[model samples]
Target: MSTVGFVMLCHTALDRAAQVARHWAEQDCPVVIHLDRRVDKASSEKLRSDLKDCGNIRFSKRHRCEWGTWSLVAASQTASEVMLAEFPDVRHIYLASGSCLPLRPVDELREYLKARPRTDFIESVTTQDVDWTVGGLNAERFQLRFPFSWKRNRLLFDRYVELQRRVGFTRKIPENLVPHLGSQWWCLTRQTLSAILQDPARKIHDAYFKRVWIPDESYYQTIARLYSTRIESRSLTLSKFDFQGKPHVFYDDHLHLLRRSDCFVARKAWPQADRLYETFLGPNHRESQMAEPAPGKIDRVFAKALERRTRGRAGLYMHSRFPRLDLENGKTCARYSVFQGFNDLFEDFEPWLSRRLGTRVHGSLFDPVRARFAGDADIYAGCLPATAALRDDNPEMFLTSLIWNTRGERQVFQFSPRDNQRICWFLSTDSNAQISVITGAWAVPLYLSNRDFSDIRKEAALMQKREVEFVNRLRNIGTRADVRVWSLAEFIEEPMENLQSILDAMDGPSAPRLTEAPRMANLDGFGQFLQNLKNQGMKPFVMGDFPATNVEMHQPTGGPRPYLVKK
Candidate 1:
């Protein structure tokens, strides 16, 4: 007869429980099962018939069990008593759930327990030391009355707790009984187990604990400390909980993860996971060497899973986990450049930039008519539509999707006051955005257009107002994007030096110096255009001061200045 016995607490999935119970009996380990009274007689009878061939296994008296209720403690007590009485040779009783499956061979578990015959494996910690709890009372769980089931009577439970707090009501704890909390799954020696079951104070402990919140977690944990000679302060079974205090269920894909735990058993496994059931419960599943249970081996993996569940990947936004605008991990994924006035101030700036950096350059993504995607495609990566109605419906998501879809490639696009200004705040706030602005550059297109001077004045005034507000946002202390701003006159003065600096910041110092510059737009009458706007009662200060009759605007950068040579 095996010295180790298993007492399984089961409620649902009777077929799966029968399989695990038979596995323990086949190893000569006496097994005692406790079925919840809530289960119908037909299902209960079926479970017994399925396991009748295993003579070493027996069923205990049925009792009603519920989450966070005393009935669970009652069921565990009755089941543990039956195990001791039926198996005289059993030295240790391992409490497991129906959903728990053995991760290692039964023989290894038996041998490992046999070596530490008197040791009790249970997690017992004081309330002050407990940190794994998610939301709920800790020490208060023991000090207050909890006759209401949190799951079944949530309103009553909360009202009663609040009432008690308002009236300053607290129950007196029994003497010499310090409350401790731990996982319900534990392994204990027969001497300590029997002492707890047969103690004269058992009635008093039970009466007080009957009204305690989630007594199943604290009953045995607190009692075992009084009788055990050696306590390992941990469970032999592997279990993990999420930040919400819900157990993480194992599926077929987690077979390798369970194996790496090296624990004897794991709970809350999916009942339909046939591969896990077959691989772990099979006869060929034996360990080459018996090692102590070390669930910490996989703690890091669970920690990362929790992080992904809560925060998700940066720059990703979808229907499932669309974080609030202010709470996103990253607004966009990769480093990308935005040109506010470059296109209007330079001829073919988009193609010029593409050639220089070997990157994709797009025109006004926020164009009122349609998105000007690279290569003039109707659709782009991530199947993003170029239609203005769809893109403008939710411009932020459109931008995030584009960046997330083309994560590895650097994106450069044109932005101007003429386009939609909805994404201005988004661009200023995103740290990944590298924005370069040439103020008053919008005037270049107005100057070159054949529109009437009165219309030009009105348009320039509106554009200047929008640009001023945008620049203020960029200059705000809270702004996160890398921002560079220059007036039209300021930029044209040293275009080559400024362009070289921008290239160095993007490509690093290893990039060769600029030997040629992009052709500047004809500004022959640009000074006169500013004068015209000012004369028409609109101030064009954003362009800075320019000589009215100056003819230097046509000169190309990196070329010789006009000189009067003596003939």
Candidate 2:
């Protein structure tokens, strides 16, 4: 039976490239790769050698692909040509990148393609579509000449482009050519590919597009529309583009969405996010075949733990001291919250926790700067920074710190009083490093500017040391009180097992029966909070809020207190 062909456009991460090749190869699909010409000769040779064992892999002619240039289109053309020539039995070709991963199993994908042998999966939009301008790219993309590469001279490039606009010089579309723009990734049948390559007007189309901006997004899509009569206006790959029209990098947190997307492929995954790849494609990925455990079981475990701890109190008071059980009307409640590094807060975690715990947890979007506490029976749950300088004098407080080193930076910590119970959650080193760059950028933006490779390496070393120091301080405090540590990665990988472990750590009864589904959280309120933050030009940070100061008060120890506002 004829199968699908893959044309992968890859630049770096040779190891990941090899894994992708192996994945498709196992499914009996042929793969043609066009590696960036900028890669060193040795690296290119090593990659080729690595894939030598994969019988169906082939290398295409090298091309130096500059951003927003015709070189990218040239590289795609080369890969498609090789696939068509070498894989004569291929019924369809799927264009993807080295970072793209198959979301569905190969067997299922093959069955889907076999059922719809003639349909093409390509995202195409005529130039007149409103969405074509969503990225703020103007009509000049098809009107002006971008002959010379401007990747290095962005300032001059902008000036030249503006100059062209002022001069009113424009290039007319060819007699019969209609402009279209869409995502660069697509899937097309062999007949459609052959027709595009063999079209008599191919040279003229190429000549016009050679000077057009980002021709890769338009060239194939336009040609595919002209040649293929049965085209589906959507790519089989799932991707999320930012305001700048750049794809959002995938991480382990995105695994749930990827599994549920029902798309065959997802793209723009980074090499550092190997955990995400492993979760979907590794040996242990088979676990995904099983059903997720009921959230009610986990909630009962939490409620039992709370009941034990709050025997004398009306409510489970987390991170608060001084029992006010008599003040309450005699209602008991369970309180649960997660506190972690600023960038480590996953959007789904808060809502998931709320749904599982049968309560509307405050979540990360809630403003922690004000530190407002609800009434005696009310639950206050949210992610907040634990500052070393701030101390809760109350002896009955319970503190839980979810420690995941997304950024290798130090977290400010204070040893809880001997009477207070503390729990420290830590992630494995591999999981910690998965989103280090992402968290580092958000937490310590000052360190990311204009640094060379060597400087970056040195900074990374410093960050690692800081992280180690922070963890050690937490361990020292563990010796003094009821301190418990839990592995976050274990919980994420095996939710049911780790949920039980967490309950055990809390001294809860074993194996509680499942209860009714918990109510959903106030997601609309969370959304509004996020919008308010954006409106105020603020974002979550590891440093917490800036120290408050009274401009009118005189300091006996210092000349003046610095009035710094949180950014």
Candidate 3:
């Protein structure tokens, strides 16, 4: 297998950039660095001096990076071309940043890719008919001179980056051409790299991108899709992001979600996120190596990530391409309509979510302000406290909604051995004669439109009769328990001063039978009511009473209680 070339782009991360460089050095990959041009001479000298001991590290002259500008791509293009010029034998070139940490052990990634050398890791995403996510669509400002602009002049940079600051880049979509999306950082084959660097037709792809949209974020992904004949995987990393639209925010709570994303890298972190980053880099992350599942697993993981993004029809802010799913031959893909009013930062993210929400539930990427999928998407259900509820209260729904269902076996709804509940059925608008159903993982975007009302709520009569029946379903198996519905309004109707009462009701150790299951009815009121208490400083998993949603371990009203607890 040929050696890999790592092209790292850096800006303000002086103190830690060298450590990242050292890590790549240890991986034995060729290293190429491009420090941002605007970096001060003193800082640049210090960084170069600090990294002097790493014989393999090569530094490029710093180029400035404007927050929302595309000038930065000029530096990257220059560096990429330079790297290829010097080391033409390198099999692959990967784009990364000073802050990004490799999720896989370098050897693991190398071995995984060594076997399949033709696929390009870039994603070619399409949502051409969609509008800019910001609101109004403008292509002139959205596309740029250099692809990424380093704030050449702070005033001009401010003016350039301002619109995107208030409104995100996704707010605009170009006509005719679907926005080809992928990772800004991708592992490109030497063939693709050479195509990008040596092609006589580069100007066509380049000039078109200079006027299209999201210049830097879209450049690489689009060019590859337009020119390169082969594509490997679409996703380079999974990211966490926020309103300012710069990067994803990293915090202590995001730990578990990171584990499940199965991506090679995640970013938009604060300096404080360093400690958490180390955990993945440490020797113990559960996913560090997946038992070396058959060679195709890693590629499948990457493709699936891109597929999920495409399925949701969400806009990608990067510049790589994905393998076309529909085309199958690596040349075509599914297309989605990209409209800006379709996305809103505040609407998508619940204000309460940032502080203490369920860490288990995946965040929403759909346009929130438009409320297009308000009735559909899973917004707040997967909080930390809902784990048992997910496993016990509605295991059937959970199993149908989450477990991978490609196995094709009948998924049982109850203890019965023969129930084909894995399938979700729904009705379409073809004059009420339209019937639609699907069977697959009910995760995120899949469960919504993928299933119909009939599919999701299959037992119509039983489901419609009353909330109590729904509540009873939450009881432990064979336990005759009466269930009641609770709403956030009813819970929060109590004065804030009485917040302790709610928590007092919820806090306790109950009977063994209670441990077998939980009551999962309309807990909306209950959760809504808890918001006030939560705002009052009642911890999410408060061990004692202060502000809690009320749920008690109940025994039959006619019979003795399961057990009483000491306060």
Candidate 4:
């Protein structure tokens, strides 16, 4: 029988790595393990001990792998060479990560490869591929030399890269080499590996690829395409990417998809998601189990109770500039509509809000391009300047309307159209510095060449200036509009408590009876609340809390205090 060789690249989580090694070893396959040199000695020893029983296992010399560098490719090459030398008669070599889980049985895979005889399963695409347009990073990865360590001094490194771009300095691609991008994981025949290792241009390819950024993804795919016409442009490993180009981490929620995918392997799994590992590979495996089970009638009762307790009478509108705050269950208000600019809100979204408000809208003559406020609604719930504009455009709307500020800018002014009417709702932050970091993360990417600290601070300063100008205008128009500010962070931390505060300010109806538990608990407060409930013999129906809107502030703060508000 011609056996298959397995090469697994692992950095951390030795216990999980051991499990993966053992699984493949049990199938009578020869396995080569390459643990990253960065892993501590104790962990490495534990991994060795865990895999000591496997007779077919071999360990490769460790290499310290760095992200977006040639080290990863070096480690992979090291493991492949070891596997080829040890198992000379192996039919095919499968390359994967320690985090990867086998989606199909090993017997099926072995039989399938035996039938194909000479095919390579490698995902390859040219630089002209539409998918490479993500984050506009395809050009930069090939155009310049990223010599500096981005993890250590990201700001300095990005600035240097930008400076190079401005100076019009670019590196040349080697002759007779076309850059092809693809996933690093692949399965190749022994003949293909021998061809790659024995190629006359092997030295030249190595020398050139060492200087390339993220070469692991391109080096093998590019070479495989050049050498083999019998290539399948699909990887056996499955993965996902987010809008920001980060991998969407696999969790229990993705178990169903993994089971259904025809791919042999799946990657980018987290160490903390032990449930996924157990569900797929455990002794009593339950891969079909849903991550979140359907809620029972009791769950619905609690959900309705929480909804009644937290629902606001005033219409909620979120500005495009701010990140939409999600509930703990990853849900946002279903009724809200997003607008690009003030004009977009007035022209496109105003009619939608007017229908929801069911009131006569005034100021039809004002164009959004010329004027700040084109019209007003019965209630405005959004960021500072936009909410302020709603109050200014039609003061009559402010008489009985509510203005809920989501950005938490501090203000000392009171707005009361009548003795008992209060219209202004303030959402203050405990730390303006934190809010700046959050806003900077969202805004700086648009202006800067990359995500560097210097450019982020610069963009944040500009945002702070705009925030101050808007709040100043709001203060000037105060006392006429019943203004009340609530700390946004506080409300996010304690949803039930904060909902009551909002209703109290609006003079809305009393909250419904707290008869049933909530379907979702506040995430930050869940641990403490659950502990308290457990001691009192109670159970929580809710899964998660409202997602916190507060941006975690970092140390070494030296930016302009745009979040500063006058008391």
Give all TM-scores, in the order shown. 0.93, 0.52, 0.45, 0.54
Worst 10-residue lDDT window for candidate 3 reads 426-435
All-Cα superposition RMSD per candidate: 3.2, 23.5, 22.9, 23.2
Score candidate 1 by TM-score against the native.
0.93
| Residue 298 error, candidate 3, Å | 17
Residues 1-567 of candidate 2: C-alpha lDDT, one tens digit per residue: 547989999898888988988888877999999999999999999999988898899999999988889999899889999999998999889999988987667666666787888988887788777373543455678898876667787777777778888999899887666787888888889989889888898899989999888898888878887888798877788776644456767777767766666677788787888677787676544423423212232334335544544453433343454345334312223223223332232333335434444434332221223222222112333443333223133212322222221122212222211111222222111111111111221123223246564554454445434444444544563232223333322222233343344334333476353232222122222233333333554442322222222112122245542221211
Model 3 stretches with alpha carbons more than 4 Å out: 129-132, 135-179, 204-208, 211-213, 282-288, 291-567
C-alpha positional error of residue 560 in candidate 2 after TM-score superposition, expressed in Å: 52
Q: lDDT of candidate 2 vs native? A: 0.57
| Model 1 misplaced regions, further than 4 Å | 545-567
> Candidate 3 residues 442-475, lDDT tens each?
1112112345534433332222232223223433
Top candidate on lDDT is 1
Worst 10 residues of 2 by lDDT: 428-437
Clashing residue pair totals per candidate (backbone < 3 A): 0, 0, 53, 18
